[model samples]
Target: MTGNHNAAPTTQNSAADIEMEPFTPHRHEQCRRFQIVSASGLSYEIFVSIPRQAPPPEGFPVLYLLDANADFALADQVLERLSRRPEATGVAPAILVGIGYPETEGYNQPRRHFDLTAGPTRDPFYAKTALTFGGQSAFIAFLQDRLKPLIRSRFPADSRRETILGHSLGGYFVATLATAKPDLFSGYIAISPSIWWDRDGLLASLAVPSPSRPQTIRLYLAAGSQEGETATGEQNAGTQTSAHDALRQRRRMIGNVRDLAERCKAVCRDAVDLRLDIIADEDHSSIFVACLPKALRFTLPFSSAD
Candidate 1:
């Protein structure tokens, strides 16, 4: 486990356990940038990266990444660094589309909670946290009716090879979308998803084999084994930190995802290509970045050189 200093960094303090805002990386020419308002009137900052090489006849697979403010640069760099030798890595060239907030902060906390959660939030997890919730429907509408159409028309993207990825709360969103609309995308990557959002959690209600989501879905879920354990540091000091830590353990992030993966496996069966990875010593934050390369492989698989 060596660290690359050049790689874009994404981190949120343990203090704001519920909040996810990663360090914004310096913009590079590889990523085209723009701003667009969803029909719901929510403004979003979009970051897109096209392959350096020519696309296949069917076009390149496309990935729609959530929480772009933090992970866009990291994702783009990962694709660029590995895709050069797709035959060996199985991480092929694909269109990278990052969906983020237009606000200046590393992450727009209020907006994200609203955009990521499904329906109204009655989760005890947010008893003390004062953030808005339940706007995923509107956000999904934007992606379907607005952003996606724009991507197809403007880029040589394969309609059937799209993937949607998210971490933490964003991971919660990805998982929710996977079940509610399994046929919406070909692949799903959810890292350290916040399944504690409800008692039965998000996947409790997802009915499978709905005439869609059969044999075409690829799902990869991951969480760090250490995600439930408490860490020692000033950033995690005080009573509030203890409360969150206790909850973290109770919530069982790794187990939650593991259960979801298994459930998806048994229930969906041949309907979905499902995989789960538990990073040995990583935590919630570290697990997201640590698992990106694998996520890409599962979602956008490339044939290995014989």
Candidate 2:
């Protein structure tokens, strides 16, 4: 896709991601700015975009946390397009608080183990890499305790009008967060979670119950159908970079999502709204883009809560 050079440029405001750019066209006017202040002293950066016309509504629904700073623009684009569609989610114009990373190089491969993973083992995938691992627990604390309150102070966000969306390891983070503190956010959209993490420790944790809530929260889980199978018949880490391996990962991840969805149905059947979508022929990288509108529509409906 051609870069929208004419669109409003993203300021290099925070020390989080070395540089941040608007991944989507910014036609709207009510754009707002944000800064990062993590208690862990871990430097991070984030931004928020809103409708061009109206002041944000009180108790407005907002997408809270986003992983992979580089991917924020794509999400913003998706939201910008979908929010205009009356038939789609019917969701009103709202703010998108995109939490970005603090890295400048190799942005696609996130130090997600640090930002998303729960435990302390150095997985070979990210061991001794320039990017660090294992900050997710703190990250969540940052969101729940600090960043969120800061956003609420400025915008009209409902106490329960938040949705956390993540991809890959980020997906793993959302699932872990949902089960660990279900009340913290109102909805969850996990795309192709890394179910392989810690031998599915996060997935297993979801089996346990959280304190019951007065109302049910919604969850939308989607995976690409191409995750597990490749043009070749086998699975190997060496092939991860291959287009084929990418396809396989989606399949494998989707299977894991299905299992989790089933588990959600079994455990919080009546208390939660769980929907699993398997997109045909899409791979991991494309799944989030392909699934975003539907995911957002399903999780955060435009209709009034009344």
Candidate 3:
């Protein structure tokens, strides 16, 4: 969801009229970094921060994903903190696989536009940008076909204990994958997904029927107070704009997430656990940091014996 080298913001820089506010420090946790490479012929990096002083056992729970950029470090730290609690010992050792941008010029925007979208459109947001915006299908192929294999080769991980995390645009891809390929993961953490993407076309994609009986999937969705900086952020049918635009956008987005979650549940309620967290006093950027601990607790909870 985060772009690099101060690349152009995803939308027009009209007045910061719709710009959301910053995050409170109380919501953040410390994090660290471990590196890995992507299969896209790019020497990318992954950040894997484990719980402090946690012993390596038979196997620790794992989360593997893209968009490690910066927020992922905090996510690693948050997971580390959560894993140390008495209720979370088994879960804290969770190994995070953060896929970083390949260190190359113009690498940030291309990956952002490509890995986050499904396909092309003539909309203003993407019409003038590079043509690499909708390579999510290929990106998913890379994760399922290459990155997961590489991680399994390196770690003693149980495929059933895997979780995937992504924010904003990355969250969009995560949602797309959950609906399109539900069996690839056991849980999903999507922080403030870009529900406004492609004119909200992603929701329609979710309505597609499944070939096999849908399996129960663990899913969490969250958004921040300042998430609404554009049409994508919040909507007000009454007031044009007000002090509540950001909050409203976050609410609307969360509502959409809940609605989508319910729709999926209708198909396979026995197999799906969908949760929504619309955190207070956070915006787009700080949301991942705030929700990290909760995400870890919910996705990788420990069992009594193990």
Best by lDDT: 1
Local distance difference test, each candidate: 0.76, 0.66, 0.62
lDDT of 3 by residue, 1-306 (tens): 333423442332222222222222222322333333334443344444433444345566678755766556466556656666636344546777777774533236566666678777544455576456556776677678766765566556666577898887778777776776767787888888766565356656653334363545678788875554443333344543664554455446666676677777786566667778877767777787787777767788787644
Evaluated against the true structure, the overall lDDT of model 2 is 0.66
| Candidate 1: residue 137 Cα off by (Å) | 0.6
TM-score of each: 0.84, 0.79, 0.72
Model 2 residue 232 lDDT?
26
Order by TM-score, highest first: 1, 2, 3
Error of 1 at 154 (Å): 0.3
**Over the full model, what C-alpha lDDT does candidate 1 score relative to the true structure?**
0.76
lDDT over C-alpha atoms for residue 290 of model 1 = 92
What TM value does model 1 have?
Answer: 0.84
RMSD of each: 9.5, 7.2, 10.2
User: Between candidates 1 and 3, which one is better according to TM-score?
Assistant: 1
Residue runs of model 1 more than 4 Å from their true location after superposition? 1-30, 120-125, 199-201, 209-215, 231-242, 304-306
Per-residue CA lDDT of candidate 2, range 71-183, in tens? 76677777777777535556555568877654432243444456676665434554566554566777788888777877777666766678889888778778887766777
Clashes (N, CA, C under 3 Å) per candidate: 0, 20, 13
Question: Which 10-residue span in candidate 3 carries the lowest summed lDDT?
Answer: 12-21
Q: What is the lDDT of residue 159 in candidate 3?
A: 63
Q: Which regions of candidate 3 fall more than 4 Å away from where they truly are?
A: 1-43, 50-58, 86-91, 104-107, 121-123, 199-201, 207-215, 225-252
